[model samples]
Target chain A: METFKHLVNILAHPTIMLTVGMLVFLFFFPPNDWFEKWNRRLRLNFLWTKKGFYFVMFLMVVFFLFGLTDPNFSLIIKKPDNVPIIGLIFFVFIFLWISMNQALKNDNLIEAGEKPEEYNDPEDKVLVWPDLVYIEFIALILCMSLLLIWSIGLEAPLEGPANPAESPNPSKAPWYFLGLQEMLVYFDPWLAGVVFPSLIILGLMAIPYLDTNPEGAGYYSYKQRRLAIPIYLFGWMILWVALIVIGTFLRGPNWNFFGPFEFWDLHKLVPLTNINLSEIIYIKWFNRGLPENILVREIFGFLIVFGYFLLLPPLLAKTAFKKLHQNLGNFKFGFFIFLLLCMLSLPIKMYLRWLFNLKYLIAIPEFFFNI
Target chain B: MSDKKKSNIFQRLGESQVWKSIIRSGIPRTRRQRMMSVLNSVFLHLHPVRLPRHAVKVKFTWCMGGLTFFLFLVLTITGILLMFYYRPTVEYAYTDMIDLGEQVPLGIMREIHRWGAHAMVITVWLHMFRVFMTGSYKPPREFNWVVGVILLTLTLLLSFTGYLLPWDQLAIWAVTVGSNMARATPFLGHEGPGAALLALGDINFVNIGSDVKFALLGGRFVGEAALLRFYVLHCIGLPFIVMILMAIHFWRIRKDGGISGPT
Candidate 1:
């Protein structure tokens, strides 16, 4: 049990979790056909099949029940405010599994040169009065009953009255916005709170425009939209949902990370010496004091930041994303790549922070500018 | 006692002037009558008279969109009830919240409202996911997808603005942390990039007093004005916008060929 707890603690580390998430994602949705045999043997699609899904769900339930045995885990999980998140986890997974199961099945049928399950004869229609309306009525009743039961079972959380002077040790945003709050650890409020959120909305809106491929219209088929599906899952599952989970359960007092079974010791501190790019270049590498001039001191930092955004697009256009560029045209390609890079930057910055204690790429507090 | 007598009684009731005026469509027995039942009713008319069989399937639609709308209705009704006892002012807000749990009748409405709000957020997200997975946002439905993305943001905003209403530490701190982000709104914020550029040698344009954060909080900090502003935005402003957008979203579904299907 101790060994198991240790293993979980290591695995739950953000760096490890994120890396594992990416690996699992790639394993499921490989960039090439190289892992086809491995994928088949693993039965990636079978994981969403009824029997496989039940087994996975059983494991999750067991794990949760087991975790609840530990006081630390139970305290976090059983919190009234966190209850919706628990439901979110289950519902998200269930719906994801359901959709993926259908998608995989549809993909197989399409490969066999048949229509998807959603294909219905237009003439063979159902009246809204009974068919649609009845289903809606049933759903509404079910939802209402569920809400009533939940309301009766658990009380809504109301903490102490408004105290302006003393803030909570780990002040968290509402569950939905927790992902943005988590980003504050690795980024400035400007980038994490404002810019990324705007980009997310814009990018979601841009999906229909960007993804001009009309192969999988009105049906669930992963094979038809392999690229689009994985990218979106990465953003939604890893970036958003996973971040919220970490923020809610893992983060402890003073915004420190706590393991599932570990106690959230209020006094516990992790010593960190975060260093800026200028400090690394001037003081550490050159064995000299930093330059007095701000621009001169942060020249290398600015060059790298500017180079990443400006130069990398053309380089990608010529190499990796050449086909994408050709298909999307210049303007659309540039916009798409910009959005993609912005999304990818989060992980890159996170890795930099973890590995090197790198705080900022460009740090010029004179103008309140940093990246 | 006879089948004919029973039918006659129901038929007579259905044929009454009051029944006709209220129901418009008589007790639907035939296919045409069923279609008319949907067509004539204001609430039911939002849906088309007939839909492709697969469109109504739980597997395909997931009923997430409908549930989200239903949750919104639940919230609005419960919210209006809560408003009767609760005051948005800083002095009364915290006590009112406590009273809601202890003194108010059917005080469980707060729990339902809170949970329902959370559920709505989840449902909206899932709805989007289902739409994306099915490629329902293609071609004619592209604008609707954009509208949906906007609605998703509004849903989050709605939840966020409502978060501050309880006038508790959780509410204030969360909003404070959240609204503090506005202080980094590029040129308009005091601590943001390019704020210094908008200043003369001796005079600064944007500072703590006049920055975006100041405008958002209505002061330098989370206080009375901030509470009132967030209250109004939460109850009225955001919901008003969301309703308009939701109308457009539902309207577009009909215009965009009544939900995407394999062509």
Candidate 2:
């Protein structure tokens, strides 16, 4: 009795009460039934009721119990709107579920020819604290409810209808898309807004399938590997640098593609608008007699594409497997690397544009950086 | 007793002209029954039957993702309401937004739409990152992951298309950059080397070669036609597609079974 009292006193400190409550609930109700059902159906279980959810609740209550006792917690009121109505409906459903489940537990005990107290037996059960379990569940649901209401209420009402003529400076995308918009300044718009972004989406989506060897499916795959580590690090480093560089530089009039707008009175050096590409190509030995700039690019592009798509894949496959053809060849590692390269293409292209701008400035002193 | 109940129901259904009119929509009896079953049962309608709720339990987390979807639904409802007063033309687009903000009855609806969109993106990304951290993208669940990726792309596309509907200078220039980027895409692109390749003598022929510039702008760059196209995509085409994808995504979640990891 003294030990139990001491334990209760320690938990009552409020600094540890939430944690204590969480531990009690987890120790008692493990959500074993949920896991069993999940595993039976999917051959795996990830929804463990013992971790995180209860833990977060425990930490908050233990750490912030003082705050809750203060006036601030009271400020978290339910908003008066359709959101609250939906919340009310959810609350009702939760209550009904809890009541029915409790009743059903009692019914099962009775049907088994056991006393009602058996369901609540303290001696026979090692960690079966139903009260604690119920408390944790309710607390977690309340937290979610509070979060939903808070989200809805935080949104400010519209200031006015949209107007076109009075274009605001630093016209921004919604905060969510600001990251992508920031990329456009340094990159070719296609690279920033489309290709790289597309690759990221594709990469995320392909993760489950690309690594789907059914080996280490649920566990971290790259943790033990050193070979892929550098690549991942490099990819992330490049991404951050690209985002910061583009967002910071290459902004202002014309939404310039590199480090702000710079003067380039190139009409004096080379009359470009009416000039035929064939004349320039004929003058150059490397791209001799090409009718258009595209013709030269295409010729080189074909070589690179052919080598990459046709020759290299087969050569690598033959070297790795000692066989040219195989039914189960996925080239997962190669594809991963290829995807990474695709992701980096935007930043690289953006860099090239920056380089060109610098060269142009150097070539003609009059075409100096504006900033 | 059951026979009498069935007979009465059949007779009532037969006598109702509305039921006959519904049948003329070419809905087979089985399909009608299924839809009616969904509409009739409150709880069952929360989820469709074809979903293998049991199977997807292991490789899916139902909590945050579900919340995000709920938010998306809220945004859709509010967005549709705001669309009633929105004008996408450059001349009146910004004015419409101002009007929505200052005038229109319950103009707060427009604020909700804008804010909802911002919130939706945050939630969706959080959902995606959660899926990644949990290693939810493993075998048998790969296709669903692909679908999720497509959904992500569509989400961004929806954001981009919707951004231009305001028809302000910001909308105009931002979309100009965005569409120009689209035109630079290989094969079906309107610019870069691809455009020249598509040209045969004076006529540039192919999917994106001929009239590509005209089609995108509706006339020239960032004009009235562009705004209308963006408006339709934002309010109509993108939403419809997103809703369908969302439905499929949810169904797939159940089919794939819930979140992956150990208990």
Candidate 3:
């Protein structure tokens, strides 16, 4: 049991969890068809099948039941504010399973040179008065009943009165914004809070514009949009939902990590000797006093930041994203690549923070500017 | 005999001037009548007279969009009820929350409102996920998708603004942490990147007294003013904006050819 707890704790770490998420995504959606035969032989694609879904759900249920037996895990999971998050986790998985299951089925049909399931639907048109309206009415009633039950079962959280002086140990934002709060750990408030959020909204809005592919426009088919689907899943699952989970359950006193079975000890100290790029260059590597001039001091950091945003787009267009560039033209391709790079930067920054204890790429406290 | 009499009475009532004036098309019993029923009613007209059968499939759409709207309506209704007993002032805000939970009749209104808000957030996300997976945002639906993204942001903002209304330790701190991000709003924030550059001969334009954060909080910190501001945004300002955007979103769905289907 102790060993099991330790293993779970290790797996729960953001680095490990994200690595696993990437691997699983790759396993399910292999980049090349050459891996298909190997995957079939290994029966790995069974994970995307109905039986696999049920098996995974069973495992999740068992895990939850076992975790609930542990008081520490139960305490966190049973919290009023955390309850919706628990539901969110289940809902995300269930919905993902449902959509993926259908997509895979549709993919199979399309591969056999047949129309997708939606195309074969017999009743092409339906009356709004009875068909759609009936569904809407039923859904509304069902939703209302569910809300009533949920409200009755659990009381909304009401903590102590507002006292500015007395702060909570682990002050968390609302569950939805927890992802942004988690990002604050790695990036400055400007980048994490303001810039990234705007980019996310912009990127989502830009999807229709960027994705010029006419295929898979109105149906579920993974094979038709292998690239698009996986990228979206990665953003939604790992970047957004997983971060929320980490922020809600793992983050404890002073925003320290606490495993599900572990106690949130206030005094549990982890060494944090975060160094900026300028400090690393001047003080550590060169073994000299830092320059007085701000621009001169942070020249290396500035160069790297500029190179990443400015140079990388054209470079990537020539190399990795050549096909994408050809498809989306110049302006659209540039915008798409920029957004993609920005999205990828979050994980890159996180990895840097974990591996090197690096704080800011460009840290200029003179004007409170850091990245 | 009694059942016949009741039916006759209902039929007569349906044919009466008041009922005719209100219903226009009473008890739709034919195909044309069904279509007319949807067309004639203001509430029902939001949906088209006919839809692709697959569009009504629970498996495909997951009814997430409808549920999201339903949850929003629930939130609005319950929010109104809660507002009757709740006060936004710092002194009364915390006490008012306590009273709603403890003293008010049907105190569950607060719970329903809170949970409904959370549910709405989840449903909206799922709705987006569904739309993306189905590739419904393609072609003519592109602008609608952008509208949706804005709605998603507004939904989050609505929830975030409401988060401070309870005036509890959780509320104030969370808002403080959230609003603190405004302090780094590039050129606008006091501690932001270009704020220093905005200064002229030691006369700094952006500082603690005049920054985005100060504007957001109505002061340097999350106090009474901040609470009131958040309350107004939560209750009126954001919702009003959301309603306008939502109108465009729904209208565009019809204009863009009613939900996407297999091409």
Docking class of 3: medium
- B73-157: candidate 3 lDDT, tens digit per residue: 8888888888898889987998988888778876799889999999999999999999999999999899999999999999999
Q: What TM-score does model 1 score on chain A? A: 0.97
Best by DockQ: 1
Q: What is the TM-score of each candidate against the true structure?
A: 0.97, 0.54, 0.96
The segments of candidate 2 whose C-alpha lies over 4 angstroms from its true place after superposition are A1-205, A213-334, A346-371, B1-62, B88-92, B104-106, B206-213
Of 1 and 2, the candidate ahead on DockQ is: 1
Which candidate leads in lDDT? 1
DockQ of each: 0.89, 0.17, 0.78
TM-score of candidate 2's A chain against the true A chain: 0.39
Per-residue lDDT of A117 in model 3: 84
Quote the lDDT for A144 in model 2.
46
Candidate 3: stretches off by over 4 Å: A31-42, A120-123, B1-13
